[model samples]
Target: MLKSSGMWWYEQFARYRYRQGMTYARKGQYHLAISRFNRALLHHPQPDEVCIARGLIYLRLGDLEAALADLDRAIALNPCNSKAYGNRGLVKAQLGDEAAALEDWRVALTHRPCYAEARYNRGLVFAHQKNYQYALDEFDLAIKANPNLAEAYLHRGNVRDELGDRFGAAKDWQLALLNDLSLDAAKKALFRTRRESHEQRLTEKLGAVLAPLDLSLQVERQGRQLNLLIQREPGTPVNYQDVAKLLQAKIVDLNLNWLERFRIIGRMGTGGMPDWDKVYQIYDNCACPPIYLSRILASLLFFMPFGIAAIVYATQVKANYAQGNYRAALTASKLIKWFYWVSLGVFSATASLVVFGVVLLLLRGESLSSIIESIRTMPSPRPYLGRPYADPHPDPSPQPSLPESTDSSAD
Candidate 1:
């Protein structure tokens, strides 16, 4: 009776410590939680639960080896613990032991037939191995067991896609989206698939409509917008607004949502003249600074003999004028006109200097040559008395002998 009472007391204390550990764990105080778990284990009551809890904490902390050890001990303490097997499978998966992980998951399912998580994990393993049929089966079972499992649907969709059932895959993805509205990946997949389908149908429908026109047209879907590109033939007349209205009518007939806008681009023939209105619009809405074209033209002038600054400035002026910024256009035109006159004046001055310098060189060539010859023929001075210096070039003339000193007595 005394021993039973002692065991009961130890069990109660162990349970209290385990509760404290769980509280710490909930608060993300992992070290404190682990300490309490260790104390709970030391009391030796309900060791399986304590081991499983510590193992999960270790797993959360990314200590795979510790997690494996604790989970193994938990399984040994209670072999029927499905949760221990499931968690061990996760650790094995993290360790890259896929085969072992799959086996663990299977064992877990055997212990608890309704284990949806284990079934889902097994499906993931099959998917990794490229066994699409098996993966699909497992995912289906998992879904049946837990209809609200969004990940199962998401992964099943992928497997279905791999099996070449695009419609089935799309259905699964839609189901996943409906199950979990916050799943961004599912949303993206559904959007992409639906967009591709819409683009294909639109292309076929637009192709039929453009057949009689004998013009090459392309239909592109960009998000909520539909872009129509019409290749313009030389000497062929096309009204862009009319074409836009026609395409919009066709799109409406197809029962698609009214596109946010229609982008009609007319493709000019090779080396053909560009539409001035289009060019103006392009420059008017450009994010570049107003002087961007000016700088580019100035850079080009270094390589080319002609300056293009005036032309670029004129283009900007025309663009601004067409956009109803008449004041800005006038100011730009005046600035460019002044710049052109200044440039012409500078060019004239530079050309005059170059011409004058050339003429001077031509006229003074003989005089300069004669002066250089005189300088070459001039004689060098003799070295000073009593100071010997080395001569770079010896003179060809003989040196005169010094007069012999007559007064030996004076010496």
Candidate 2:
């Protein structure tokens, strides 16, 4: 009984020494921790926990090889030690052996399912792989295990943003900031995502309105020269001859109207590519308002190959229909313009499919085919201007009544 009591006392003394070593290690006193750990080992010849404490201290001191050796001895003595696996995984990750790190983390998780740090670390590995969905799932589990985990929230928010779930990203970032007010990363991410989302919505609204920009513009270039023509509206009559004369003189002076007014709008560098951008702006803002539709079509032609001409014309023709310029709209129908019609018919089916796909993608359900079909079915106009024809024999009008009689005889 006395010997057993002495053994117990020795065990307590060894544990005390091990704890002192850990405390010193935590305070960055590596030499003191090492000295104490050595003393503990002398007192208890084979103490696995003391060995673990010494190994962790060695790790904290950056003696990774010694730390790993101690950890191996500790694990061999206590085969079920979960913390041993976790520490090893940390070392492996530091060494950039991600697979080994992952394996160790999985083993640790198998022993302790609620290990928040392990889960967070594994999630980081997945994130580095760009497997955002997997990373997010791991982060979600970590957060569930430890709701106060600000790091988990931040990482999850980053993954959400990458997945294009901006709202979810912002929510996670906001939550992270709320829990850990000092986490500057969380705060910055929240602000950035919110601003990006706001800007994205603004762009979408503008995109919807400006999708028709491909309709009202035209561009043509002859060797070493480019010309952009915006057709004037027939309905809104202007001095065509005067404008033509002005254009001729400007051409002679090599000073087009767009070049003069371009400076008023923005500098050339604002749009990067001047020729392409200048043409689009003119189509959108020029006074040849009806011709605006044609200008946009011409710009589309200039950008894409000649194959896009039909699609651009279709878009312009549809815009014209929307504006009630039925004559110009009808003239735009490729079938009525037999020259363009014959050109289209000559294309192979493969080319036709390509053009059709491009048109559908650009139009995005604008009903171009139906508009063109309707315009084609309408009869060609005669050389005359008159009110839109209703039914020639209109519904019978009420018979006209005679004026009232004097009625003096009746009175």
Q: Pick by lDDT: which candidate is best?
A: 1
Q: For residues 6-26, could you state the per-residue lDDT of candidate 2 as single tens digits?
A: 778887798788888889888
Alpha-carbon runs more than 4 Å astray in model 2? 1-3, 43-46, 201-411
Off by over 4 Å in 1: 1-3, 210-220, 228-249, 252-260, 263-411
Q: In order, what lDDT does every prediction score?
A: 0.78, 0.65
Taking all chains together, each candidate's TM-score versus the true structure is 0.56, 0.49
lDDT (C-alpha) at residue 169 in model 1: 85
* TM-score computed on alpha carbons, candidate 1: 0.56
- Evaluate model 1: give its lDDT: 0.78
Assess the local accuracy of residue 351 in candidate 2 as a C-alpha lDDT between 0 and 100: 81
lDDT of 1 by residue, 1-411 (tens): 356887889888888999999999999999999999999997766799899999999999999999999999999999999999999999999999999999999999999998999999999999999999999999999999999999999999989988988799899999998899998888888887787787767777886776666556666776566776667667877776555556655654454444445566676664454442221111222222244355336534532233466666667876876777644565566656556556666667888997786567668775656655766888998877885788989999999999987866863
